[model samples]
Target chain A: MATTRKSARTTPAAERPHPDATRRSQRSRQAIYAAALALVGEVGYPKTTIEGIAARAGVGKQTIYRWWSSKAEVLLEAFLDLGEQAVHAQGQEAPYAIPDTGDIAADLKAVLRATVDQLYDPRFEAPSRALAAEGLVNEQLGREFVAKLLEPSLQLHVDRLRAAQAAGQVRPEIDPRIALELFVSPLAQRWLQHTAPVSYAYTDTLVDYALHGLAPR
Target chain B: MATTRKSARTTPAAERPHPDATRRSQRSRQAIYAAALALVGEVGYPKTTIEGIAARAGVGKQTIYRWWSSKAEVLLEAFLDLGEQAVHAQGQEAPYAIPDTGDIAADLKAVLRATVDQLYDPRFEAPSRALAAEGLVNEQLGREFVAKLLEPSLQLHVDRLRAAQAAGQVRPEIDPRIALELFVSPLAQRWLQHTAPVSYAYTDTLVDYALHGLAPR
Candidate 1:
């Protein structure tokens, strides 16, 4: 989400500008992220501690403390990094923004299809679910993660919808914030609650139904 | 919810055939439900135990096991009872079906407004969040609760959509299951994730948007 926070925490020691130090620091950070995700996924958010994460990552506890304030921060950054990795793996660049392909429907459908794949990705599923589960009851963490992680992504939708409105695709009077929910929240609930199965077809239908209305066109 | 399971578990011993036994049994059952809800709310799902609920309710462990198979079943029944009680408090009868006033939008809005109130209700909020949180990490429990506690309520929406379709209020080709999510899921995700604040106005907007579509009509 916030590039500044990630960069500030993840960057190598400013005093040690050596290339080898930077490489080692990058390896350690990646290890920390991996350990944090795996620990949270296996033991859940409540039981996962910084000590456990450091132990699992083969890093000193001081090293983890030096970079991040809490396990929550670590997990949050890990998830953000995981998202970036997923996008890069799909051959997209970092800070991936929604495509403005001049066709709102096609662009929205493409993003949602990608999201469906991400939701099903084994790498993303367990840790995400664990964190989400904790967020439900842990109100402070819930609000923090929503503000930092989820809201930034949701804002992208608002931006796209506003663009659509300017282009005469979406109604000018519609609230982009609420309009995005019509398509996004259903898939989220399905994934979070295991309420139903999700797929390209399901998300495509959501896009069409959102654009065309459930009532007569 | 499944009425048969509730009735079978909640009923007094069939062999007793005495009014006193039935009254005592009903009192014990209510006490157990209240205890289960309070305990789960206080300590969350993982830490809550049958012995703990039994002690809190001042009932024997055998009484709990005799009636229900596990804590999940107990909590599910308690929530079902809580919903029934909420409806009753609203001066509505049990088995509270969605109203079909022939104006599909109005009917959906009315139910959603009631749901917003229910979500805000203190009695339902904490325990419900705790159960939902646990359900996220625990697959079998999640599936079981969704099937028993959630799907039945969702089915009400499906049924209402089907009626609207029959009456030509909704398009014939719309899948009631998917169509219902347009309005239902957004509210659900908001409540579940603390993604945003929910209110009657927000839900009313959802109903309007889902019915009318986001594009220019």
Candidate 2:
């Protein structure tokens, strides 16, 4: 449940850009993120390169190499930045958690509805699909991405499920890790496999099904 | 839902192989299926070509073209043939359905265990992973593959669930299509993403979680 797969480190502070260059570095960083995302979305992971990212970002190759060691690292941080921007766009703080409204079903439904929106969002679609496709075949990257990008969100659900269990809303015998998947994986399959259309209604139903028994009470 | 995605026909009898060449044609067909699956698994979908399949199968280019129109079509049929082989390997009939033993939960767990075996099988894994990765990015192929390959199996689940509903083992109001995913998609996500290990115990837990509400028994 806890992902320790994020890369070991980035550029050290002592070797970092001075305050005078901080503004310029920040601008360059954003450009690199945009460029990385666009390149990956356009040409896919195998074809995407640090050279392409640097050229598209209008920065020298060393500028990219100094901060991130590989294209994968750049894309990983780019996705993190995208998520931060999405949060900030909604007038939230840098570290946003899934709202725990005390009502387990309602909270889960709300979060899944937001996820449905993210899946449908054009800006998120191409890049996510590209990354997910790469992950399907690339085991190392897949595990790393799931650890860093996916599991954190999943961990939030686990936390919520644990909280629900504390309140006796959920059965304590159920494993929160797997129980959360009861709702999560269905929506994911629908999106990733195009098995069905996604909607708020669909996610709401998932929450309902996960909470109430599928069989007659 | 029934899939209308399969192509109209295989071949016209008049243009088919002559009686004297029937055995040779059968051999060539199996070779083509093997080559198609292996090539796609090795080089992936885009780089995999009809020429590659024919060459690998040791048949002429025209031999492939005479039957299938495109690489996708070849892969699709190859997958179907592979599935039939898996069924036969299990000592099952050509058109196998999930067993309904008057217990919905038991039947679901049984089918999911079989799915877990298929997911683990080397013959099924490589080609399935390759095709699924391609489908993630290729909309046309994704829809077609899901309609042709995945939906048929899902329909079997639907039919069984409907029977359960009639037997009052499932809630009448529950939509079987979505309800089926409660147990099905978790196993799928674990297999697809390697989020966790899969086992018969795990799938059995899913059935229990689904059939008996997560809130309480």
Candidate 3:
């Protein structure tokens, strides 16, 4: 449901004749997204309501209800927007996907290093953690977050790994879904659980250890 | 700090003369732990007060303060106690450590399989998930959880991997700490995030992938 939402506005939308009204609508949507993220981060999921988001965004309650059915939908779209903004801020093009550079190790390491930076970005950290914490207990919201947000990014890794397999980089027998977790989950656990520090060198080592067995080659 | 507190009392404490008083104290403590776990599981971390736990446990508020400093401390000890109970319920002896069966793959797989069982156990699942969710947002609580509960278990994996390294089963330069995550964190992420289903077969595959390179040998 969230995937189909056009989170990023294009020049074509701005190119519409009633430019003032379009700009006003865009401003209201951005304010609502920011307010939703901030409120969720501050008070957490259970306490955050559409009324709170509307008040925080300086819009009427009807404005939020007009756009989203629930606080979960609002937060989901807010997160998706945050991700796209983070990507654009990094000077990457819209619709970020894992690079398939032919050298699987180099490709994975580069993407993970980019991920390390994204994880550290203050804009992305607090609100994302807030939603994730809520998702741990709330089954419906958790599944929605996974389907709309996480699974899409993970599927990019699957695609990259499949490309690697075709190129004889990865073993054909490997399941890319499970295989991607070797490097991804460790960084995730560290970030989510505060288990350890993450760094470029650390992620680099993960790629190496994963591509080459821990057991002596 | 939490590690030093002996969670499981042995016969020596039970063997002391004043056996009726000792039995009563033990029963009260068990009731308190049960109350803490249940309350956290139901209401979540922020709202679970010591007074509330006492009310649920049918003990005075003073009884709780007499033993622990804060709700975090109580929950920590409660989790530690829960872990010990799970181990005992598995019919394993006290000081539950991973078995070092000389075969590194087999040893790791066995431990992970046991972990799969533990994750599925209803007694462990709800409270543990609740606490983990709290840890994601609560920095101090999260760090304490890592230092006391998580790191000790991870250290056991490190010890076993170091043994493997010594035996030339793992490469000499391999950092046992990071290597363990290639398998461990995946299971943890799946459980914590509900990112996917976890099963013995899934974990068994993780072990096989980690031990053998995803790349062609």
lDDT winner among the candidates? 1
Q: Which stretches of candidate 1 lie over 4 Å from their true place?
A: A1-15, B1-15
Evaluate residue B188 in candidate 3 and report its C-alpha lDDT on the 0 to 100 scale.
98
TM-score for all models, in order of appearance: 0.93, 0.92, 0.92
Which has the better lDDT: candidate 1, or candidate 2?
1
* Candidate DockQ scores, in order: 0.84, 0.76, 0.84
- Kindly indicate the candidate among 1 and 2 with the higher TM-score: 1
Candidate 1, A24: how far from true, in Å? 0.5
Off by over 4 Å in 3: A1-17, B1-17
- RMSD (Å) of each candidate, 1 decimal: 3.9, 5.0, 4.4
Candidate 3's clash total is 0
Which whole-number lDDT from 0 to 100 does residue B27 have in model 3? 88
Top TM-score: which candidate number? Answer: 1
- Write one digit per residue (lDDT tens) for candidate 1, span B1-217: 2775566666667643477876898999999999999989889999999999999999999999988999998999999999999888888764769998999999999999999999888888999999999999998999999999899999999999999999999999999999889999999999989999998899999999999998988
- Tens-digit lDDT track of model 2 for B103-157: 8888988888899999889888988999999999998999999999999999999
Interface RMSD of each: 0.7, 0.8, 0.6
The 0-to-1 C-alpha lDDT of every candidate, in the order given, reads 0.92, 0.89, 0.90
Chain B only, TM-score of each candidate: 0.91, 0.90, 0.90
**Clash pairs detected, candidate 3:** none
Better of 1 and 3 by lDDT: 1
What is the lDDT, from 0 to 100, of the residue A6 in candidate 2? Answer: 30
Of candidate 1 chain B, the 10-residue stretch with the lowest lDDT total is B8-17
Worst 10 residues of 1 chain A by lDDT: A1-10
What's the lDDT of the predicted structure labeled candidate 3?
0.90
